[model samples]
Target chain A: MIEFDNVSLRLSAFALHEVSLTIMAGDYYFIMGPSGAGKTILLEALAGLHIPDEGRILLKGEDITGIPPEMRKIGLVYQDYSLFPHMTVEKNIGFGLRMQGLHHPERKKRVDTLMKKLGVGHLAQRAPLTLSGGEMQRVAIARALAIEPEILLLDEPLSALDPIMRDFFVDELRELHREQGLTIVQVTHERHEALNLGTRMALIRDGRLEQEGAIDDVFVRPRTRTAAEFMGFENIIPGIVSDAGGPDCRFDTGTVSFSCSTKAIKGENGAVCIRADDISVREKTDPGTDRDNTYRGKIVAVNPSGPMVRIDVDIGLNIVMVMSRKTFESRHLKKGSEIVLTVSPDDIYIISTGTPDTTCS
Target chain B: MTSRIKPDLCLISFALVGSTLVILILLALLNITATQLSDIPFLLQVAQDSRVTDSILLTFTAGLNAVIILVLLGTPLAYVLARTHSRFNNIIESIIDIPLVLPHTVAGIMIYLLFMQRGLIGAPLKDVGFIFEDAYPGIVAAMLFVALPFYVDTAREGFEKVPLHLENVARTLGATRFRAFSLVVFPLSIRHILNGCILAWGRAISEFAAVIMIAYYPMVISTLIYYRFTTGGIKESTAIAFLMILASFSVFVLLRLVTRYVGRYDDRV
Candidate 1:
């Protein structure tokens, strides 16, 4: 396991503020954040590029914070692929082996194995400058893996590729992780990439790590208002908790109350975080008995969101719901249409309970 | 009619002004060659003359040696300047460019004060039997002093073009700082370094006032041409001048070709 104990570093105009995280062995860990969020800085810190000003970095329980990158047994790949333009594909792949003092024959064998594995063996004699983007990316990855690092740090590895190439590399990365059993830390801002590949992930904002946990927990249940927004929680309704004696509780929003299952206690001031995809909309009909957390509302707006359609509904409070284009078209929904919105009790996540300024709205 | 003619007039004037230097140089070279082509035997004799050939060879050799030293020592400084951003580095960059802006005579005088016998650096070297008074060392010192900025500035630009992440990746791949530089950064910047060396060498060879100030004997082409012009009149100096122009142009063209060939891979990406 790798651990960062309250690491703080100050770069020009940006700083990572007492950020700490633990990445376990064999975990595909992703560091996700917005641009200039210090995600790359944390990855670089793990790669030993930047030394923390006030903390310790431990690798397998050893304090390797002060060690140089060459001795860290870690590999880093950048978004641009940073292949050695002076060397051919084969030579680029063999560079790390040569640095590690491997004999020529053994190095050649290992390079050939990695090249074939990464599907760039045919371009071995060609210079990196002559290779395609995908080809160069594979060569760079092969070069890093030739050293057989214990941990590989990738800085937006797929952000440079086109959509199709990104899909291809996503699968390639998944297979590489499974085959090598290498602990990988990837930095990205794309939520789907993180959800698809990461077993565990961290969310960062303004240089501070807001939350970190298993992918499902962090995505489904964020712990802060900022984390909820970043994790795509579109509905954050401030309210007070009541009826907290059982597995479910009532969230009284002063205007309306929502039945939610949460760990929050009675009289706690918090907000119910709900993903846009969780709230479903249907045509309003006669009042039904299954109206636990359902409400009749009017569609205030209909906005197309790529393959999904976002409908803003006003049920005494503004709430956004997203559904697939097919489902939206089947419902024939539009602005001013009357609809009923229902959210499961399990989908409502209580966040920032009892925090100051979290007044009921 | 005026609107249509305005752009045409601007284009013609711009083209004329831009081509003026090329036109003047071509005319001068043609005039010199035309005057000398009729006297092939005399031209051949000038080429065969020991004084002319030896002076030309010495100039080329000294310029080449100066460039070699600059490449060896200036490369690291150039790399450092390229990778670092600070007030101190800015000061160092301005100092490196001092030779570029200084008058050639002032540069010569500076070199003379620093490296002349009984001077600051020359005094200690003189005690160790390394004299710089009217010697080969003095000629090279003057050349190096004047050509320092050409090599360093060009090499620094080349180093700057290479992304720093390449070296970082190399370090993570188990290479030390030096290895990363030597294997990754140096090879990528070789074309720039070579171009810088060529430019410095050209500047060194063409130097006149500086070399004359420090070392007038063991004449370089420029100094030899000056001495011949002062003592032997126009006819004698013209032949050497034509030869020197022809030789320098040929070498300059050859080096440019080599640089182009080395940098052919640059545009592939």
Candidate 2:
């Protein structure tokens, strides 16, 4: 188990601040953020590459905050494998064991088994420069693991590979994770990779950790407005409270009204989020006329991305709702066409927008 | 751009530059006298001379010794300069190139003043039974002073380019800082060190003035060549010059092969 308590790291242009995290034994955790959000810094802090200024880091209940990186039993795999180009794959993989002065035959036997398992057994005789990127990455991992580290850390391991090769490499990593049950702390900018690999994810934003939970829990429901937006919730419709005294309050957007779930915590200026799949688009503006959450919107644009198309509908309030391509195609919605959008009260997720829409705006 | 030279101008410049370089080579090759060319076979009589063999051995040993000392001490210093960002690092780096620019004769005078028997360091050393004025130490020092820029500059470049991330990965692989440098940094920079050795050896062999000051008694091949040219005449000097060319040529071939082997790993770019 690795635990970070109130860790804060200040570097050149960025900081990883007050980040407290727990990596349970055998858990696969991912740290994800946008560029400059200090994902890499967080990984470095955990690996003992950078010591946190304000906090303590404990590995297996022992404070390892001051320990040198070499003494820490943590494996790190980077995008560039950092293989010793002068040494053969066998020699590179055997380096750690050799440092420990493991007998020649014993070290060779261990290296051979690892080599076969990684399926690079035949290439052991070759120089690292002669190997492919994927092969080099495997050798790097093998070399790190030859010491049998207590935990493993990867920093954008697949970012260096091209699209086609990335899939195969990701699969290889998954197989290794399953077989070893090694505690992992992987940092990446790619969301899909985090979702696929992480049993749970810690979301780092700006300098601080925003939130962390099981993958499905965070995906379906996020605590903060920023978290929801980052997780790909595009429907942000504006509305306010009207019947505030009642058990359920109705908020009016002037153009449209919503039976808001955000009524309990009252605010004049706020943003509401409804997931793309949650909002249903209808051809005729007939059903649910008297309902609270109904708006007539013009389908501004339709973007087709693989199996799903997201429709941007203008609801006259400078707000847009995104819906699936299948739903848009079935309904036959086109640009410059009129459509009606409806949302359930439970689905009307509204919170204060602290930061501007830098991505969308 | 107007600065772009026209094809006709470029052709003329290229031809002019080629002619100038070829003429310089031609001049050096043509400097020997007709009598010297005729007496070359008679120099074979001098080739069997003990002085000739002793001079070659001394020159080769000193050059090799200078290179060995440079590698032993200079590589680690280069690595530190490569990795450190302190103000002193830049100052030290700029100072490293001073020997290449300073007149070798001036360096020789400086060494003579500092290390002669009555001079500052040599006075105490003489009490300890150490000799510096006309010995192998002085010869090796002279060669080292002139030959070091090649080693430091090349090795520093090698260390600078080996991305710091590689060393970090080595550390994470459970190797200590010392182990990382030994297992990762040293091996990766071997080619650059090879480049340094070749340049240093080439510089050392071609050195004249500094060697002329420090150890005139125990003659190196360069001093021997100078002696023969002034005393025994041009015939003997050209023959020794020819032998130096042959010796340097084979090492040059070896360097080319090694560079090609390294170039395969990292593309020329």
**Segments in model 2 whose C-alpha atoms lie over 4 Å from true places:** A8-18, A162-172, A205-208, A216-229, A235-259, A262-264, A268-270, A285-292, A318-330, A351-361, B1-39, B118-120, B228-236, B258-269
Residue by residue across B1-269, what tens digits does model 1's lDDT show? Answer: 35553468888899999999999999999999998898989889888999999999999999999999999999999999998777699889999999999999999898888888878999999999998878899889999999999999999999998898999999999999899989888888889999999999999999988887888877999998888899987777889999999899999899888888785555665
Rate residue B45 of model 1 by lDDT: 88
Per-residue lDDT over B1-269 for candidate 2, one digit per residue giving the tens place of the 0 to 100 score: 36965579888889998899899976776664343467767756766788887887788788889999999999999999988778788789878888888998998887778778888987898899988777987888788888998999999998888888878877876778878888778777888888898899778867788887877868888999999999988767778776666566777898779776873445421
Tell me the docking grade of candidate 1: medium
lDDT of 2: 0.79
Candidate 2 reference-contact recovery? 0.58
Ten residues in sequence with the least summed lDDT for candidate 2 chain B: B260-269
Estimate, for each residue in A1-361, the C-alpha lDDT of model 2 and write its tens digit. 8888999888756787899988898878888877778888888888888888899999889999999998886888877877776678999888878877799999999999999988889998998887888888889889888989878898888888888888888788888888998988888877788778788888899989888878777766676766777777776655544444434555566776678654433434455677777777654635664544767788777778787777777886644556666776777678888877777777776654443232110
- Residue pairs in candidate 2 whose N, alpha carbon or C atoms collide under 3 angstroms: A309-A325
TM-score of candidate 2 restricted to chain B?
0.85
Question: Across residues A1-361, which tens digit of lDDT does each residue of candidate 1 receive?
Answer: 9999999999878899988899999999999988999999999999888999999999999999999999997988998999887788998899889999999999999999898988999999997888888988898899889999989999999988999999999999999999999999999999889899999999999999999999989998888888788788889998888557557778888887888877657778889988888888644563534534888899899999899998899899999999999988888778898888888788888885684332232
Most DockQ-accurate candidate: 1
What is candidate 2's CA lDDT for residue A250?
A: 58
